[model samples]
Target: MSLFKRAAVSEFASNASVVFSTLIIIWLSIVLVRLLGEAANGTIGADVVLGLTGLTTIAALPTVLAAAVFIGVLTTVSRSYRESEMVVWFTSGLSLLSWIRPALRIAVPAAIVVGLLTIFASPWSHRQIQEYRARFELRSAISQVTTGEFLELEHGARVILVEANENDPEKLGQVFVRIKDDPWHSVVVSDHAKTEVAPNGDRFLVLEEGMRYDLTPGGLVTRLWDFDEFAVRLDSKDAEQTLRQSREHALLNHKGRPTGLLLTDGKSHSDGQLMWRLAIPIATINLALLAIPMGAVNPRAGRSFDMLVAGLIALLYFNLINLSHSWINNQTLPFGVGVWLVHLVFLSLTVFLFWHRVRVRAPKNPSD
Candidate 1:
């Protein structure tokens, strides 16, 4: 490596680290705030919130890294130009295109990391997140029931209230249940009931010495029954393992499947995902190169101008990528054109900018 290339690479990397860290910290703070509400609502546990945030951050790292590289190169080159250091390099016959070498040195590694995250780590994290949500949903339905408070379950299909004996979790002294089913309304009052899980793993509230009154909805018909003991299932499904298929496979799982499998699946959704994973890394490189010329700044002007422009470009690039994913999924655009076209357009833009920068004459300082 040339001395100039090594110095440029080091400078870009140093700037990138600072920018990347700041962005991640800011992003994490915003995410934590959004998740805190869910934690309070019991939708997610406090411990799980942090884990989920970390996983989400991992999933988001590719775009973050891409933005970092773009801003890094832009800041480095813009600073050099603002301070008139670029004039010295240009006079020394280093063309504007030379920035690609140093930018790539930093970008190639970032791109590889992005690839690993998009292809493998991100998908795995997504699967973990789905599993966490499924477990929480299943448990929340039962856990919301509290003694001494009337609780509505299954969107008010049933209502139950229990008054338990002092210092006993299982011994309830009074139980009331209101059940509303089509064409029937029933109320039950029990002297005492014990909460138990049956041998077959069914959850039941077994009532002793209970009287049940039934009324036909909107009718004069009524019935009453006295029972020594009766049991009602607490959960709609028996208290046994209920297997649920995951929805994460619709997006992330396809990345882990063999490329051939995706091709054979004959699903547009799978094709869209496969294209997305492959495109992210390529986008990283294109954005990196594009950042070099975009980062160039006038020595007299402040660094903020180039930074703003770089941000806009990054925004547009990512939006286009996301739009492409949707287009492919909807079959509005062919996968071949939808996925790679965005990268190609940006890559061409980068090349044109580099060429224009090379042709444009640099202003001279007479003192030099």
Candidate 2:
């Protein structure tokens, strides 16, 4: 309840909010522009681009919070040293290690938010993104009909392949199809094709100048027929929904799993991902504490060397965490030994630096 402690905590919280907000704005702008480009190229639907970008930003909050904590602590401490306030505190018995109390107050809440995002919100966001992509692919397959790709229709019972377009957008350059519905299997190849619509709103791909191969299920009979024209109707909306659900079910992976589920399952990749998620908040706290000792500065210097050093430490810390994830997933490192090693290493380093800062200070002359 000391004035110094209250003032320091408030200052750090304020600085972190300002810095975190600014970094979020910048990161979102860059991510949004890239995501919008994906939308334009048909990688994702235009309608969901902004929503996806928002989810993407939410998933990235840990990185932003970490950076904000680093800068907040560094800025707070370096400014103290530069203005000679640290000298006053050092003389009055406030050691450099004492900075941890206030720094932690900000770090704890930030860590909790990071954990929530990483554990729950992130998975939900990724799941939504995947569903949006699946829905777009389904709608685009029937509505837009891009060339040079195979479009699966009717729960894998029928497949339609389109080759590169030849000039007229309304006309398909070349079409190939294979259909297997219970007792019969057939192959159809066409010189060119185009889409036609009936009065009832049913859409069909009309093939021109084609050959058909028809076979019985028992291989007892086979026939080849030359046809001047043929028609394959696109699936109805209900059929499309079935296909979409099938695709969604197939794509359920670790990225879409909640943290609680991942914790219980403990598969190699899932465990690794969960550890990394937990590490973000832990890493933020570690880096903030580390920055206290790292951020001692000479005000006369042209640039803030302490700030740069803190940044380098953070960069190295994150890279090591990434490396540890790979090692754990590959079975080179034990799961129990993965992320904690990084934390312990940096924690020791922070403690050492803080101890050195305290020990290296000169004794105050009692006469003064």
Candidate 3:
């Protein structure tokens, strides 16, 4: 390789590393904060925070890497222009188009990484996230109880307090529960408690050798009873509703499905997902090339305008990619067309910009 190409590739690599690190740090901070908030609210267990954070970061790598490569190419070229290095290269018979090779050297590899992530690793991470949530949801409210702390379930309609059994960490001892049933309030005190799943798939908290007291509001009536075993249904209406909302909130559907499955399905929704997965890697290459033209700026002029324009173009590129997904899924656009239309448009823009730059600002020939 020529010295110019070597220098360009080296600079691109360094800049991309800086950008990738910065973006990953920012992304991780945001994800960790959100996951910690969810953990605090009991939406997810605190123990799984790190696991989820890692998986979430894996799922986000493609977007972060794409931005890194794009910005790397843009900044590298723009700096060359600012430093008069481009003028030197142009005067030596190298055109603006010469940058494409070095830019692609950085871009093509990054695009492959993005492709692998989107097509395989990302979906696997999403699937693992869903599995984590599904397992958490399968646990009964009674099983969520932490000894020495009062636990509220079904929106505070039921409250439980239990002490740990020293001999068996999994067993609960000295269990007390208060249930508010509007017209009547019931309280139960039990020696020990365990969770049992009925044959019909309902969960119940089985209180052993317990005393039950039922009292009316304002002490209008009171009844007391003793029993060897008492069962309290854990699948309350409010709990079920909460579970449904949680499921819907985390539902990835096609996003979490394997690529092989997506290909075989051949449905519009699956096609839409396929479009998005394929678009990310394609955009990585297109945006890197597009930045070559965008990076051409006058040394005498302010950079704010150029930066703004470049940002808008990149934004529009991704937004249109997203829009194409919606259109394909809705059947408003055919899969074949929707997948290529946005990419072709940007590629055409890249080619036109290169041509204009070469024609309008072509270096003067020494013979002329």
Summed backbone clashes in each candidate are 1, 0, 0
Give the TM-score (vs. native) of candidate 3: 0.81
Report the lDDT tens digits of candidate 2 across residue range 308-367: 777888899999999998887787888888969999999999989888777766789999
Worst 10 residues of 3 by lDDT: 236-245
Which residue pairs in candidate 3 collide?
none
> Which stretch of 10 consecutive residues in model 1 shows the poorest summed lDDT?
237-246
Pick the lDDT winner: 3
**Tens digits of per-residue lDDT for model 3 on 178-282?**
999988899999988888888766788889999999999876699999999998888733445556665554444888878988898989999999999999999
lDDT of 1 by residue, 1-368 (tens): 88889889999889889989999999999889988878876667666788889988887888888888888888888888888888889899887888888888889999999988887787777767776666555453335455577777668887888886676665787889888876888888897888666666556778899999989977999999999988766764432244245443423466445455666787887778778888888988898899888877777777776678778888998898888888888899898898789998998999898888778687999999
By lDDT, the candidates rank as 3, 2, 1
TM-score of each: 0.82, 0.74, 0.81
Model 2 has an lDDT value of 0.81
Q: How accurate is candidate 1 locally (lDDT)?
A: 0.79
Task: List the candidate 1 regions with Cα displacement exceeding 4 Å.
Answer: 45-47, 145-151, 161-176, 181-183, 189-196, 205-213, 219-231, 236-241, 247-261, 360-368
Query: Arrange candidates by TM-score, highest first: which order?
Result: 1, 3, 2
Top candidate (TM-score): 1
RMSD of each: 4.2, 6.5, 5.4
Task: Give candidate 3 misplaced runs (Cα > 4 Å).
Answer: 143-186, 190-210, 214-223, 227-252, 361-368
